[model samples]
Target: MEYEPAEYQKLQVRQYAPRELRETAEGKYWRQFKAPIVAKQFGGVTHIDFCQQYPYNLAVTASTRVIIYNGLAPAVVGRTISRFKDIAYSGCFRSDGRLVCAGGQDGVVQVFDANSRSVLRQFKLHKRATRVARFGADKLHVLSGSDDVTVRWWDVSAGSQVLRLDGHRDYVRAAAASPASSDTWLTGSYDHTVKLWDVRAGGSAMLSLEHGAPVEDVAFFPSGSIAVTAGGNCLCVWDLLGGGGGRLLKRLDNFQKTVTCVRLSPLAGPDSAAAPRMLAGSLDGHVKIFELDSFLVTHASKYPAPVMSLGLSPDCRLLAVGMADGNLSVRKHARPKRAGVGAGPGAPEPRQRRAPRLTAANYRYFIRGQNSRAAASDYRVVRQRQVRLQAYDRMLRQFRYRESLDAALATRQPEVVASVLEELAARGGLAGALGGRDAEGLLPLLRHLVKYIAEPRYTRLLAGMAHRLLDTYSGVVGTAPAVDKALGVLRDRLAEELGVQDQLSGLAGALEPLLAASLAGALF
Candidate 1:
């Protein structure tokens, strides 16, 4: 005969647990980057830019120098340009990766040859500090913005300013050259306005729009038909082909601090035909990526300090963030090597496999009871396990309901007691198990009921048990002092819970009118 083990009762899940954040494709892709490599500078990192050509060198502008880092070996410094006597700003590379240009605190824009680190050209026209500088689409011209409230275009072949636009009343801090055309440029100013300029036209702006806050940075979509502006805490998108002045397509206010930089994802990847994404960094130490079409935030990353500038490589293999604390963090993704494939030039070699030991020829390997070992084709017997039960379970199996309840209570586990009580109720023996209990035996049950009756998870079951308890002990209430005191405490707790429910109902009623009014106004 075989003995069967009694099944353990499962406890009900009553508490609410918050759901975890769902991981998206964008999150998985971005999370492939390994831990960042941090570098410290003399002062805050004002700007970071990656070259468009092969090797994809990174240019970082800080205090009084521009440091060029090898893209493949990010921890290695390839070149340093320290020609600026004062602070340098917005150091960026040309499309060919041969020339670098940046603005200076001395109101000068200088271009340096990447190989020799020599200054090739300098445009010195602005009266105040020149803060923004970048190479134009043609790679032969440079565009610069200054604190003197002007935007100047310079020719690299000849050291001369080609075009100057002077419509901004405040300092121009942000500028971008269109990817589709060499004649068009976008500039953002502290006057809360973004102006689009075409060099073929006059010096005045061709189109202007109010940003409602001081503009920090601006970018143009690859098609040149859409523009994005970053201001106070908002990123705005505009349609350039919409009516006369263009229309505001969307206003995304997702950050609590100023948005300092905005950039578009690379358009040269295999997924280039897919909808593009916009990346924005804020002083809140977060960089959020949003879908251009839906404007929904798909992923986000947190930095140690406020992010002042950030750049993504052309191949999207590296992410560089410059912080206000002078920390430059660079993250790179390492692709997994396929089995049986050769490693790349700098990849580490695969580990060697060790040969197995000659165990069959060793006498000790077989002498220690090894002859009793079973062969692969041999059959074996498995012994059945003996069942073990707890004291409460054993009592319940014997149909001693009262003793089982006592054992469950002595365990001091609320779930165990609740399970026993539920089992007794299901078997239609609850009244008999609870009967014939003196004041000392009934005190624990009363205390447990009083403590848990207010909880929504146990209210329905516990409240019915409390009613039955009162009906059974109505005649003996005054005789037992401890039992009488517990009943009084339970009465007070129920009254307090009722009062809380009434107050919550009143609050809900008060908020109804305001919500209705807001909904009505939105519809109208």
Candidate 2:
């Protein structure tokens, strides 16, 4: 047997904000497609990153464990590497995505095989907590920053220290590898400065640029000629091309809270002349995407709690936000309007395979170059149109008599007509609904009410309407067969009810004299 949904489940679902209201730029940017897919965590998420290639797996660092998730289906954890002796703060995937690396509070950086969950290399050089670590462009070295105020590089093959660049006055928080060249990178520190590093040359830093506040996160543009840093509610972009150290390209300060993380879109590349967008995650649970050329926030969204980290899949279809409440929120784009093996826009329509009796509507549609399947879908019949009664019920409760009566009459349904009449009587709106209606327009509702004139629940409300309708259309009733029959039935039911009332009145009249006689005898 095949499974089927219940009847109530087959009703059409509506969007929270329909398409007509989202024509403006701001409206489209803020519209939420759907509810987020949530994954619970034992501790707050600290860092997240997606693989550089297809399948685009996710690496998340939380508490003392680093977990890997299949980006395509995030409901399950692929692997959990909990061998860390202390809290793990940051994690990233290598360019090939075959290995995952993380920095921990135990003053060590460890790299593990993506599938085996076994540590491939562990660098124990930092004296204090390691803040960030990621693979370099060469994929043979691991770069890390630590609370010891130093950024260090370790050779993955040798599993030993390559160089230690120490210049920051405070802990280093964020770092990024340059994609255009393997020898260069950038680091941001709480010391309120961002330093450019070149491992090929032995020095503290190739160049240092001053920022007025502590740096929380940093990212390099696709061309490696620009860099962005997030800190203290502001984002600063620098141009690294001029003869001087570097020039300030732009400063974005619209956020109301500190910006904790910044990431460049994976779609950005060096060859593209158009300015690419970057994402900024803040402590206020809001994420903003800014275009580099205009320095304007083009899109924004909110999470359930303060966003601790953010990542986007390689295909740009999936976005993951890690929140302070220990929940991961994943959002997806809407599916295309038409999708099938050969159903894309402008695809040639398939010819008719069989002949059947066709209607004028379908014939005209196909003649206009529309697909037969699409035309048939437009004329499909709906079995449960009663769901629209909810809207009428709302109007009646609000005393919108004109709208309620029109909707009830359109359906010619007994239950709906009776409901509208009862509400009109209760709210004193019968005159407003039917005061000036013509005979033809009011015939359907009158016929439905006369059929149910004997039921107690509907009798009182229907009787008043039947009398008012007859008074308006009495002379013309004989011209229409349906109207004449309904009028005769209504008259007979009303007369029968009046006969019962007369009998009850006479019995009360006789009992009144008997009661008076009994009272006089008692007094004597």
Candidate 3:
């Protein structure tokens, strides 16, 4: 006669709360960027910009120099423009990628030839430090914002100031030129306001919007109908169209520190069908990517220090982050190769084809059923695998309840012990199982209960088991020294757990009034 094995009971799984950030396709795409290539600079990296042409070199402004890095090999410094006598800011490339411009602490804005590294033009009209400088969309003009609370337009050919707009009451630090028109541009100032200017309209700003905080940076949508401003811990979106004053479209306050930079993805091209994303870097060392349509964070990356500036390459293949610690970290995403194309010069050689194997008539072909595959209509024989019962399961099969509990306890697995306890309780034999145990037999169980009773997962089951044990063994407690000691330990542990819960409740109660007052003030 064949013996049947007892079935193992399945244990209940512990569930956890869902995380705020989930793994999505966009997150996976961002994760494909490999570990960064870190480069140290003499001073904090103030700005980073990638040229909009082939070979897309990057211009990084730091200390008193603007360093040009090869776009394909970001770790290599292609050229350095060290002509600035003072610290430089906002090093950027012209549309043609042949020229680079940067503002200096000496209140000068200079343009340099990318290949020659010679100053092509210099404008020193501002009375204070020029913090922002970039080429306009037309490529013939330059725009600059300075600490003098003024914005200036410059002619590259004549090396002279074309126009000066002075509406901002404080330092003008952030600026962006409109992609649709060369005459239109915007500036964000420390006065907590963003103003849009059109050279054709006048020397005055055509539109102005209050940002509610010291403005750090500004960016325009490709269509030029919308704009975004970065300020204290927030990004504000404004509608630039039908205008008494530009209307606020949305306010994004997901950051915990000041937002230092904001940029739209695919910076050098027309908008694609896929909704454009906004990239924002903050002093909290986080770079967050948000979908323009939904305005929800799609992905985020953390840096080692506060991110002062960041740039995504025009091709979207490179991401460079500038930190306050003077570290420049660049991460690159390798493009997937086509079906049969080799990756590069170092790709592995193709495997050679081997000679055909021996025919089925050979004994070696059939030795291990190596080529056997069942056909759709063929009848197949199924073999049953022998079941192996655990010690507790074997003991339970024989109806030895106390021995099964002892066996479960010997395994030292909490889940297995809990499952066995639940099985005994379901059969109406839990009390019987726990009964008839001597001091030596019951000490392990008591210790396990004491250790796990306060755990949320096993609390309810262990508590009931503990109560039953105390009731059954109340008369036998003082007879055994070990049992009495365990009981005292259990009492102390329960008291500590109760004290923690009481303190937590008191803290929550104290916070309630303050929360209510803040909510009321916000509502009013």
Candidate 4:
């Protein structure tokens, strides 16, 4: 006897299409999951930030009001009318999620209790519009930057200005506090400069760096050793640890429009070994997440309107985007898969287990030259094994409808069974495979198909095949009571699904004639 190479043995195998893999667990999780909630604001949403505390409430600012939403998915919790005289431009949630702070175009900085919606403190520090306001590293201080070219730190409990830093020649737009300490912070200005400051040192900036364009937003990496600034169409990164005047690390410019906002992932804590990726929202309707060191876009998502504000939850499990069209889009992160879990119990078990690499039968174990006594030689442990290829899959790929139907029925694999049924239905060979009117010849296959008719994963495919099978064998199929009962249930399910499709089709058909009449009327 001659032995052929494994590659040339002509064992049956099917080339799986990309869509077939979509039926796998990971694919189904990503492709089929739907967003559980979506809500709209009255005006363009200026900002959306999630609370740092448990229950993870969200703060949304639009027009003249600030609304706090509670729960994992957004639902209104409480709201506050910040300024009656003018629009509220910014809103932020404190580290404890107990306080909500916002800045108004009327130059007022207000802090309110998140739950009661009562104003805790209000500071009238800026002479012009207050563009941004946020709590510092500590709850005792609140920072606000305004068009008046000033950055003021107000004592929240004391309700007095602790210090005022004024150096920019133009309007101050964005500011961020360092996570490492409350004394340190960063602010961006329309004067084309980014200023690093220390609240401990009175009224002067510690360092100032030119950005060559009006700065839009500023954020500090979780470690506080790196600062990122968005302006015009570029993102500039600076190294706070570079000693001599904070070195320029890298400049990123992927957007064609002005970058509106930039935020660092809160998941990357101070003790993290690596810096967090940065999320930048731009006027071009895209939010780009970039890897810190590489400056490569790791992930990106698009919205129907320009992305004005972006916030990542403390756990990094959810991201909320505020769009220019007042649409708030929240996306949940895909959960990581566990290592040892497998397909459900209905999955087929392996028929043959793998043999040991070197069993006692192949290599006798010896210790100190004594005869091998390690369970000695065992033929069962050394036997060669090969997987039996799934015959139905290969036959279906080869277009052998009749043979594939029989092979699939024998294997009892629901997915393989559905594939064969779908292919037969698609190719107009379903009747031929059933051997019309020959009930004796098709009863076994019908029994196999009936076993999995109600399975959600394969119901649609089996339902159509069942309908065709019944029509072809209507005269003799009802002779068996058990088979007839199963067939009746399948018929009922298919009819219900068909009714839904018909209603939708009717709606679409009605719109066609109305659209044609409208076009004719317009022409006349």
- List TM-scores for all candidates, in order: 0.66, 0.61, 0.72, 0.61
Better of 3 and 4 by TM-score: 3
Of 1 and 3, the candidate ranking higher by lDDT: 3
Error of 2 at 37 (Å): 1.7
RMSD of each: 9.1, 19.6, 6.8, 13.3
lDDT of each: 0.86, 0.78, 0.87, 0.75
Candidate 2 C-alpha lDDT tens digits along 19-54: 254444433533533467888887888899888765
Better by lDDT, candidate 4 or 3: 3
The reply for model 1, stretches above 4 Å from the true place, is 1-18, 267-274, 334-524
* Predicted model with the maximum lDDT: 3
For model 1, residues 113-232, the per-residue Cα lDDT tens digits are 998999999889989999999898788899999999999988889999988898999999999888788889899999999999998885789899999999999998889989999999
Tens-digit lDDT track of model 4 for 267-310: 44222334566889999998887767789876666778988898
Worst 10 residues of 2 by lDDT: 336-345
lDDT-based ranking, best first? 3, 1, 2, 4
> Which sections of candidate 3 miss by over 4 Å?
1-36, 54-56, 200-202, 242-244, 267-274, 298-305, 315-317, 332-427, 432-451, 470-496, 502-524
Which of the predicted structures, 1 or 4, would earn the higher lDDT when compared with the native?
A: 1
Compare the candidates by TM-score and give the number of the best one.
3
**Model 2 alpha-carbon drift over 4 Å, by segment:** 1-33, 268-275, 336-524
**How much does candidate 1 score in TM-score?**
0.66
